[model samples]
Target: MTPSNQRCSVAIIGGGAAGITAAAVLRKRAPQLSVTIVEPSSTHDYQPAWTLVGAGEYDVATTRRRLKAVLPAGVSLIQQRAHSFEPTSNRVQLEDGSILEYEQLIVAAGLQTNWQLIDGLVDTLGKNGVCSNYSYDTAPYTWECVQGMQNGRALFTQPPMPIKCPGAPQKILYMAADHFKRKGRKVELGFCNAGPAIFGVPFYAKALMQVVKHYGIATHFGYNLVAVNGPGKEAVFETTVDGMKIRHIEKFDMLHVTPPQSAPDFIKNSPLADAAGFVAVNKHSLQSTLFPNVFALGDCAGTANSKTAAAVRAQAPIMVSNLLALRMGSALSAQYDGYASCPLTTSVGKIILAEFGYDGVVMPSFAADPRKPARRYWHLKKRFLPWLYWNQMLMGNTGPDWHAKREYPDTLPSISP
Candidate 1:
């Protein structure tokens, strides 16, 4: 069905955290501009809480809301999938063969999870002791699998880099291990990571090694999950040994898989995409390198920052401010410092609040040593963060800027049990 030409002052490409927050901020700050969001989903999800949900600590239903309920009152919404982008004409093509023109475009469309990349995974994802926390439907099954297992090898696999919430794959591993410990179940846990290190930041990684040692988890670096024989209760992993590809198969009582991810196809095929298929934006300004009138943030943006919702919270305001400056014919003064936070859930009542900025500089919001796991951070993660996300962040309120680069010793802190 073809429709007449539609135009707006600004068009947002996704209704996720970045798009919704940007729209709310624009409406509050620049009420005169006509904003329209192009999104097909009927519900908005607070995905950060999914880790807790998978661990049986949170309810999955509470993480979702009707899309209309969260959107600001004045903004317009187009409930259709975006098929393509015509940046040269400032137009976006919808899946239904309609064109929407705009004076400015914001590509906040998030990345896509490639579940089918692993062979035989789709056929046995939610059953046969294989589950994942990446999806709302599968997350509950993760807890189910953990509870049903009495004692056996429970393998957790992390795909290559660039997945949203990079710590999520291991977060559930720690949670499951903690659950087993509390229940007096003797379950063997293993972490199969494609990356060489457990975490990106050396400061946090050093701390995490202590936790791993405490749990006695076998760490398999450079190993990537390639296939799952669910009925057979086996998983295949591949690794490179001196430029040669080697495959290893292991038996498991349960498996948690974090699939590979990439930018959505529509954005990847567009001219706005960088070589790696993410929106090419200046790291500091969050403005598209190709089109001055275009901007991008969140997981889709080609930036060095860790892809987390905390990154979205920091990027949205800067993107909105810089975008507004561009519209007003002023200098883009707002800058993003690549700040992101990860509350590593070491156990049910403990967390290591890992915060950092560009170049992996340790940034701590509190005075205590950031490497130490504490119960306070756990409460912050399980109680305060969800409220901050839904009530404050989604309402366009950028909270206090407490996180900053702080000086700490280069050596690792003493390991504790």
Candidate 2:
């Protein structure tokens, strides 16, 4: 059967947080422009809540909704994977041999979590106390592993950078440590990270080190998890000392692995990609460097912002605004300041909401000391944020009402548990 070519005013790739939000915004601002979303997944996940799910503080089912249920009205959905992009022709090729021609294109296809890059990981996952909060099936198992452990070594591994939610790998670790604390059990906890620091931002890292000391957890920087032997309860890591590569093996009763991630291979090999295999775009405008009509945002764009849904929230409005400017044949006026937020859950009821812009400048939405762990932020993470995410952000409410504001720090009193 031959699939006929379809044309539209705009085509959006990927249906995750970024794509759906963009479609909604486009539909609201430009009702006449035909907008189509190219996505293959039937389910959309609120991924930021996965850490809570892994900590037993949340139900995983609440983090998901059917794709059709959340998409904005009047926006078209193409339930197919994008095979490749042909920017010169302003068309996207789908896996089913159908072609979509568009006056403007936006690529929001997110990064790929390559679990297979770690040897023996695929076979061992979801068993032998091996788990990850990164996947839907294994997140619940992480809570299982945390609850079942009595007093043996529990290892949490964080791979190299450019991974989504850079603070997530440690968020679950904190949850497990807090869980063990409540039981009066001391699990020999270790954080094996490929990076040299606890976090990218210095202000937040200084505060996180205090939490690390509070837990008495061992920190091994420059160590990357490379393989797992589930049955034997062993994990292998590669690191360097004195400019020499070395292998370190550790045995554990429980292991939470955050896998290495990268741009999807299709995007990496495409002509739209930059040197590092991400969509080449102007950092501020998010307009493709090669094609004027094409734009990109989210994890797939070669931008310096931290890869988190909060970043997508800030980028969404800017991307849509600039995209419309392009359509008008006017200069792009909107710019994304590389804003990203990570609500670092330090305990079941406390979170340090770290929000920053380019060069790690603190850009707290509220003027409170972002360094302090607070109960309100936890509720924001657990209660308010999720509702806002579904009802507001994803629905294209990107005006001043939707913007995050910085208030006076001293005015907001901190609450203690």
Candidate 3:
């Protein structure tokens, strides 16, 4: 087959955390290897800070920066959307009818936020008290909705599992509840979770449940939001019990919706994906099982780890080390332990930093008991982490060494073998 387009030594499919980190590391470690980043966005967002932004504690502007500013020197940026992958020819097809050939491919294009999955959601989002922190555009509106409400029914909904930052859906709820309490507002707050549990890990779940009780939030397990009528201030939910599906309608004065998410359609439909539509890769190595030269990280990879930026931070180095080693015809020694961290902000001044790996093994980074809420953790979440993300992580100066050694069982079977 004939091809017409540009060529590079390495072509990264995304400019997000994973792609940027990989590029930064490659630039530093392998200077002669030409690199080009294909991304559609002009700005990069530090999404972890959006929870605080929604709570009116942090300014939204600080969470975003020009993508050019963060990218490493000597790395090329192609500000275009990738339409498809041609692995056999080692080429990527762009939306603008351009093709890029590469010696190796790294797919870090994060998940897609499917707001359209919920009926009437797209038209009403960021208006009529319907807000979502999942978006940079709508997050500020969440603060607006939170500020104007004196006290009524506030519903925070969590869609199914595998969403990025699983704790974020509830973290914002805690922020809103704390805000309402401080203002002496009488509000009926409800947390509608599509999943059956409060938290995935039991150690952290106990502490979170206490915070949930303190806020007097009614919990609805197995409830999934299916539709929203923003003008009417009504929401529709679906649930299953004993193999029977049920529908429930609830009225809300305010709604914070975490829309459903999945791997981007281009990656899902490509030959790189598994049955689940994620790029099929060896969970530990981050290398594509189908294609040796292809690697994936962040939300789009079918890894068993929680889809947090922390997971990507832990994953980037290993992916790069192994990738470079493969290029040198050396043995690949890097293996990811499925590390992920979730800073569960219990309140404004307190947080329970939940760090764990495969199979929910409690991995605490500090000497203090991770089960209890600590103000120090709050400081780390509010101030330190954002700085680290911008200065160290995206620049490829960080690794999983900061992750706390798992204090739990050694013999426990991990989610992956």
Candidate 1: Cα lDDT at 205: 95
- Tens-digit lDDT string for candidate 2 (25-115): 8888899999999999999999998999999999999999999999899999999999999999989999999999999999999999999
Please provide, for model 1 over 305-333, each residue's C-alpha lDDT reduced to its tens digit, 9 standing for 90 to 100. Answer: 99999999999889999999998899999
Error of 2 at 362 (Å): 0.6
| Per-residue lDDT of 216 in model 3 | 92
Point out where model 3 deviates above 4 Å: 1-4, 408-417
TM-score between candidate 3 and the true structure: 0.95
List candidate 1 stretches off by more than 4 Å: 414-417
> Candidate 2: global Cα-lDDT?
0.91
CA-only RMSD, every prediction: 1.1, 2.4, 4.1
**How would you encode candidate 3's per-residue C-alpha lDDT over 111-188 as one tens digit per residue?**
999999999999999999999999889999999999988989999999997799999999989888888988999989
2 or 3, greater by lDDT: 2
Worst 10 residues of 1 by lDDT: 408-417
Error of 3 at 383 (Å): 1.2
